[model samples]
Target: MLTQTLPTWLPRLSFAPVNTAPRGDTLVVVFLRGAADVLNMVVPHGEDAYYQLRPSLGIARPDDSKTKKEERTVDLDGFFGLHPNMSPLLEAWQSEQLAIIHACGAPDESRSHFKAMELMERGVDDERGPASGWIGRHLATLNTGNSSPLRAVGMGTRPQRSLSGSVPVSALRSITDFHLGGDLRALQQMRAALETVYAGDILGQETLSIMDTLQKLDVQNYQSPITNYPDTEFGLALKQTAMLIKAEVGLEVSAIDLGGWDTHFAQGSSAGIMPNLMKDLAEGLAAFHADMADHQNQLTTVTMSEFGRRASENGSLGTDHGHGSMMMVSAAMWTAAKSTGSGLGWRKVNSLGQVIWRSQQIIVMCFPRF
Candidate 1:
């Protein structure tokens, strides 16, 4: 029952030479902890069926001039639009640096939060699958000369299941304190754990140097380019990720979580609870997008959740767990206009179970040859 609390940062620069892992863009994974009503985040205004199914929860169309800006969807591809609170991400979309993939599925069709999140993070469809996460497998299979302890980072009190595997991951509680002066005890403890891969002095020294590099950049006061990152926990996670990317500390991937997405009541169609969640998500991402302008070609940000909401709303004015969620990817490497996926067109099929499969591509694509 422990949790992470956040608004934090640091930065610099270094170009990776040839023959290193993650020659591709650094990956930042933003996971919505609870089952986010993705239908609201990525509005399907063009689909009349969507409106009829959740009339009370349906987002107003882009052309609803009478509606307040926060009451209408921001058109993305004419057919789909973003929730009003997600307006912050529009800039990335306008620049064609963002892609929207609709109707992704969960491994568990049963709609159990614990089950689906576990399977999704572990990158498996069932208990029979490997316990290690997809990112872990990626690191284990690809052996590039890069073995920095900071290679993989999970922002929280614990490393995400997706980060569990043969590879070592630093489950950081504070990005600002990821250095020797801050977590010496933890580092000393890690020394024993990583001694196999990192010779005693090597791990310590490498980590010291990385932190020193970060200290030199004064990451604690990093200046974002396009816009400032919000002072929220989610924003803090991203700011730290941005700092790491800018610092060039050999970071290939980082995972961040944003909770409170289970909107079973007062999910809000135009402005309220859920909209606020959208605001935080969109703002944090927008700020990161702005700060990452220079690193866009070498950075890919993706948002995901456990599952989607039911097409029908409950009497509580909220949504129940169903299936068929969606994911949004922001990257310069992304060229696809928008992924319609496979079964969403029918207006009912909950992806028939394709969420984990398709979303993995975005993650795998981050490592050039991995």
Candidate 2:
């Protein structure tokens, strides 16, 4: 029995009551806005076609003979490899906690970022699909009775389309700033007045709950166990997410965005724009995974983009919008006892050059347990 009403004082956002004993894993969805170039991110060193397609942009194959690892790819399975900048994620792969879904994307062929993002976020195959997001629908189906006010959160100025539905979700820029606005004396007066006005109703009760949550989320005093997070916006978002999870405030889902992936010019190889972004992404994710190691059994993180870059590089040394992209999933819910395979029954490519593109539908359908 989740409460769905929005408080008038907090008209900007909404909250939901979480079940005392909810069932299911907490989900973190990372949206790599501005289509990421999967081809170079996950290097295909074995494929000569890949090297030939973008001779300048392609990453160098893994070389044991080379003294400098920065100039080459980090071999994952001989044929396929990771961009050297993303070395932070190597451990996750080795431990089998990370799974890569190559050539995955929405069915729509439109390369427009807005349209593509809308389609993907809505979890619809066509333009006329339902308005509610896949995550919103998923939460609507769950039996989370009157859950925590922080059930689903979008970490930014606005909530992503994925969390749009009947369920109350919060859009947060910073947890530290989540409070009643006013100076010291004004704040005290406002709080006292609000308490008097909401003394004995659901609104008052929920307001008290929110106050308690804010106190619990005293982010200024929290310290992350992992120390390698990049000093970037993405890193900060993930750090806050970890804090919320550790607080056990009934956060069932979170959506974070990392933009600037639309590399259309001078996208360098091993030492350029792409590499820096890749480093930020890899380091942030790796740090989050390490910081939340104790709660890995109940956490699942997934990364997706609107689409992929063109198979071939453009004249500007970057790439244009392309058909197929990739998805990455790191889940503690998938135990060592379960099959390590993607479970989607898609063919696994081991060679660096092999291009596997099929009608895999968008990632919403690929969500675990959906």
Which number leads on lDDT? 2
- How well does model 1 score by local distance difference test? 0.73
Q: Which residue ranges in model 2 land beyond 4 Å of their true spot? A: 1-24, 64-67, 202-207, 216-221, 335-370
Worst 10 residues of 2 by lDDT: 337-346
The lDDT per prediction is 0.73, 0.75
TM-score of each: 0.82, 0.85
Tens digits of per-residue lDDT for model 2 on 187-223?
A: 8898888878877766455746566566446554455
Runs with alpha carbons beyond 4 Å of true place in candidate 1: 1-24, 181-201, 215-220, 339-370
Q: What's the C-alpha lDDT at position 300 in model 2?
A: 84
lDDT against true structure, model 2: 0.75
